[model samples]
Target chain A: MAVCCPLLQHEGERGEEARRFSLVLRAADELCPWVEPVALGSCTLPARGPSRFFGGEARLVDQLGAAVIGALDGAGPVQIGAADGLFAALLAARAGVIVPPGGSATFLSSWSLAVLRRPDLAVTLQRLGIHTLGQFAALPARHVLARFGGEAVLCHRVARAEVGELPGLRDPRIGHRLREVRGELPDVTPQAGFFGGTSAGDLRAAGAVARLQARLGPEAVLTGRLGEGRDPADRGRLVPWGSRPEGRHPGRAACRAPAPWPGRLPPPSPMVVLGDPLAAELVDRAGRPVRVGATGLLSDAPARLSIAGGPWRQVRGWAGPWPASERWWSGRRRRARLQVVDGGGEAVLLAAERGRWWLEGRYD
Target chain B: MFVSTDQGGRAKPDLPAELAARARPVSTAASRLLPLPDALAALFPDGALRRGSTTLVAGSPGGGTTTLALALLSTVSAAGGWCAAVGVADPGVVAAVELGLDLRRVVFVPRPAGAWADATGELLGAVEAVVVRPPGAARPVAARRLAARARERRTALVVLVDHAGGWPFGPDVSLTVRDAEWEGVGEGHGHLQGRLAAVAAAARHPAASPAVHRLWLPSSDGSVAASPVCPASPTRSATTAPATTA
Candidate 1:
């Protein structure tokens, strides 16, 4: 089914670039319908499980070639090469595919010396006049190994179609996201009403409630437990708005209010009991709550410091070129401190030793 | 300085039409003098060397002047255009292999000891782009003739001038490669340690001002990597200014 199409298509009048891309895409698409299409370099179809699914290796490849031709719209002059390694497949593709199951070695053995002219193998092969793949394969494996090392063995393997391994396939479905959450709030009191709208129930019905919860600021929402077990499904969930699950018995249920919800809410209204106050805060060098640090200071050495996970930065503005030298007795105890302003407008002390300077600590 | 206050303002004589035309900014001339890359945008950013135009790439050996020329050749060939390289210093096979050049579309013309210019002239009209490393010096007149032939045929003629030698003819863009430094080796005993230096020096025609740019070459792993080169120094010559459009 596939063979006639690509062979015919290859004969058609199409731009070379477009033709090439389409040919590779169609080949891969047809050969491995189980695996999604992947275009890596010049060839498209790679080694995978589909070869086994279509009954033994030979049948798989014949099918792949046919698929390639079909995808190419029968423009075949399509070359199909299947080997354990990408390099081998590429070489085979360049050299043309082998017929039947075990013909790869014979096909590769007759290949020309020019194939070995790949940059990595060229220089070493040039000395021996081993220009073609056939010549390279004829050389003693041990001698080739001793001279060109492992690469020679690998090349020989490629030439002999004894390719040992296939490259790992990359995950195609990882990190894929499809759902989007949207909501409209009329007032702060009706914050839950927003989620209770059409989209909310639709998302809940789809079992995508977790995704919706993730979309709603997770940190702002608080979870509460119901006092009485009523509706089995709604026993543990209550939103910021004064909305409770409709059930026969009214028990204390888990309740949460998003602090950042858009809309006005009545001040001091008691919809849900607060557990603990949580707010974002910054810490200072001394780990104390202070308004600002002192800026005026005199020191000779320049201060250098860096923010956590940030780039190194130097400080300017000092009162004096004061020089302090210590550690003369111990031979390794020098320390010179300087004061400078940091990004936060805090004056900090920087120390220098053995010529290199550092911001040891900050001042309050 | 005393000015002639001659009120013989019997109205100054009107300038001649030819002089007036010269005085008026020539818009076309300004565009014609744009750098080759800018001029080449009309063709391809990675365009085929213009047919019949002589492009000069002059630099010291190992300064990537030849590499740049070969890269251009590769690009053209990859585009399915036919090309030929004549009078190259390195062996044709080795050069093709090193540059990853497609030899199928290329005709390698070995550098005949004394017949480089003649060989290039012979192949110029037949190929889409011809890279020639002419033997000895090419006279400006001969270069001009070649350039004229190139222009007439619309064939791209890339002339690799050895070292800092001057071009035989005024090139549409004569790019000169200057100061180059070798990137040092990494610690340990890896033979793949030494790569070409990162910096490249270039002077474009029309603007003859020299510029030093950091070059990133393709690596074995097929990753693009960067190397720093010496910064460019300001031009000293005041006579040449960049071509300005009216």
Candidate 2:
């Protein structure tokens, strides 16, 4: 299967567009398991294997048509072109013709010059009155080649059905890995001033960490926490990589630490460790959702968050002024509060009104 | 190439007589063309899906429209074409896995706010096939843009319509899935057990009349399969006597 993006020229910023094209290719890879996409001009795979598997060329084309339809699933209409070469297939698909075998030359013979005039090449061909493939092909190969340079030579070959060698097959075994970090600091105060007050800093910190991790490779970052004493220590862990410490070991510190008051400080709340730290959000462009990352919300926040590549968006209606404070008895006490809302109207309250914002527990 | 003719020295074509006969000029009105499959089938037919054509698969909730869509994906993947499922509200990863699809080969794109149509259109330009599950609240214009994109990219699209309503693009094929019958199997002689039912659906193709097929869960394996439960020939009575309940 080959994906050809005709908007390569019309869309400004070619690099960004190409990256988006790659994302679509990746998306196609995920939607269909049987067919491996070979990145050609946009993306292509040899039809020979597929044809054989489907019984014959005709069957293969039918299967391809169905596959394309299945892939689109009504998001929009789609066109499919399958043929012997990259150019031929694209042309066939564009013309809405399922060209039969040995019809490449005939198809090229009738192809209009407009088809060859890409935005990048239209100006160069106008001077020659080269309006059709037949007209261009009629010229002496050497003369045409001399005037247009290598492009003319390549076009001449394509028109004559002497296209260049096919691109090599891509490694089908390509894979990826991710790393991440998460933590929960409860019993901390919420400052009413900031987004979520106390937890806001940690969330921002987690965002920064996620961004840093992304630089290492393509990954996503997520920030969320549970409510008051719910699974205390406010659990968080990176997936597909670093994992929580397992089994009691002398090398690893246990949850308990000696309290300064000999029985105070809430038994030294459990420590947050980076467990199986795997990163999320592996994508090129096109904003394609490659994988789902961590789903958690700050205390007094929404129940769930859908993190693709940016800040977490609240899942349900939840707005907060989550009131929280720490070191209440000491002169060093702190307070904070915050609110979080999603584009879908769901809001979460992370802090309550106080002289200052303070960190508070999460909702779910 | 040489030309041949009859004894009077008239040039005759080298092509076979039958071929020559077939090439004879004929009026369009005289031709009998095959009817187009319903919009849904047109989009993902067992044969070539005509470009520039739109197919709409519309059904109510729990009608198994999504299941049918996934089944099409399985067919496409098995045939070796890259495919994608975009904007799927429910990822349904387990179901896809159960169908024996290659997870790596499939890409799942989640777009919550209908903004996915634009990005999906751009993506469709490069991929072999793309499936977009528009949010339930998609507008008519959004649907049209998607259709336009499909035409521009020459991509085949299968739109899953969640509600029973008309689509912006008068699809070349329209399919509706409905429950046909329900049966319950008991764990023991007097114990009521799980319920199973068969679904009857119609595929209306463009240029062609509608055809009906029945989908039922296999008794042994519990997988859905479709067969021509209703006969097309006119030899038998259109209506048969209903089976009596015990």
Candidate 3:
């Protein structure tokens, strides 16, 4: 048996329109687990079980039409057909009729050679005045093979209602493609109870992240979290994804709740905060090194900034010197921050500690 | 002062609502396109990120490339779409949060080391979107294979580059932040506030002309919003931003 959902168009309908087509497959799948997607719009399965359960093929087709039409959302009419094989069933589907049991040969007899989809063979047969399957069937099997070659033998069998389907009729990639679009790509689909309520998107993400972690050490793949802190770096931490809070002392591996922290940089944190601060130099216009003194003030008005002894970039604007002190319980230490916009229109956060400066973040 | 003007396309802020909307696995794939925040929507020909397409967000080292790339992923993540960031090294989580991403839906392969391509390839079919930043100029053959794989899987692949040329192949959509103006900070007064980035978009469609628009990449409150100001010229000559008082 086969049903063609109107939603599947051959014009690359694999995108948005493909969803409804998948729905038709789902409805069919509910009736039987072995539903196979034959092509863009049509699918097939063993008709015996579903037909028997519904009392007869006609009754099953009626219920299947209702279910598939609902899935289509009125997109188009659903075509249902059942016969001995895929070839006859698809032809029966087009005619929107059920072939009686043992009636596939009678049903397929009147159809033209075009249904075989072999244009060259169909053209040759048409020129020979054997226009319909019945006429082609009337020819002797040995003569058909001797004249038309190997493929004609298969077509002759199909015309005689022997084979279930043609080679190109069923797209073997349909199931694989549908599962991929649903983010159900793992060879062995992990059961749902294992992950409560996470979307297929999330499951897909988890699978990919796991693969990357396996390839590049567990610590490489991470998830970001924000917590209470005074600077961008302290506020945002990337913990190895899936790390247990108990493994790193409860409440630390995961981000803590946001709390008021004094001297914190205000709204709009830097986009890229460096893990390893790059050494930088700042100087006054008179060619003198600029410093942040003990009073949390600049020793001189800075005019130029150079990163790691690179070419000097004229400073266009500046802000900060927000002093934050810590470790007073052990030993007192102080650090100050500054935001500067260079002449090239790039903004960077520069931090000074112990009279040394380094690039801390970039507002990219 | 930058005021946020919400776009019709911004995703729901609540995770529960997004989860509820996720029950229909088929509906998401129906669009063949991923949603983008309104501010960046006009950049693409379809006003959405087409699945299987590659978009390159390019700019200088400090020219808002990171911010724009994150902004591109924020709406999708907020909508409960799974997103992966490869080669970001150290991402500012607060910045990502403030930019509108639902952190729970985003995974970061901050350091892919030598297997960046492999990591990205593994993620293409599994996630709705994957953001990759190659450590250096990517090789043509490797880039070609990745692009082909992305197309085959129908995943939206966003490549972040220091400059457009860093990617060996031309992308389906190419967006570059030409320049930006800081609105709040002065020589020594106020604080670091919003930035109005002058961005240019050129999609591969032959019928559509390239476009330029100014956006508050990190508007006053940290979310990306549209700027009321006119776009700057393509010659990169003008900086027409008037610092609006917040």
Which number leads on DockQ?
Answer: 3
**Cα lDDT computed for each candidate against the true fold:** 0.41, 0.40, 0.78
What is the overall TM-score of model 1 with all chains considered together?
Answer: 0.29
lDDT of candidate 1 over A249-362, digit per residue (tens): 322111322223221111111111112211211222333321221232222233434543355344433322123433347766544333344333333333444444443322
- Chain A TM-scores for all candidates read 0.32, 0.39, 0.53
lDDT of 2 by residue, B1-246 (tens): 654435457553355775444323111122221112122233334333444345566665434555555544543333223345665543333234323333323444443243467545644544344566677656788778888877776555767776546466565556565542222211111111111223333334544646555543221121234433443431221123222211
User: lDDT, candidate 3, residue B19?
Assistant: 58
Check candidate 3 and list the clashing pairs: A16-B30, A364-B64, B1-B244, B1-B246
DockQ of 2: 0.01
Worst 10 residues of 2 chain A by lDDT: A263-272
Give the deviation of candidate 2 from the true structure as CA RMSD.
28.0
lDDT for model 3, on a 0 to 1 scale? 0.78
lDDT of 2 at A298: 28
Error of 2 at A343 (Å): 36
Candidate with top lDDT is 3
- Model 2 spans > 4 angstroms off: A1-364, B1-48, B164-166, B180-206, B217-224, B231-246
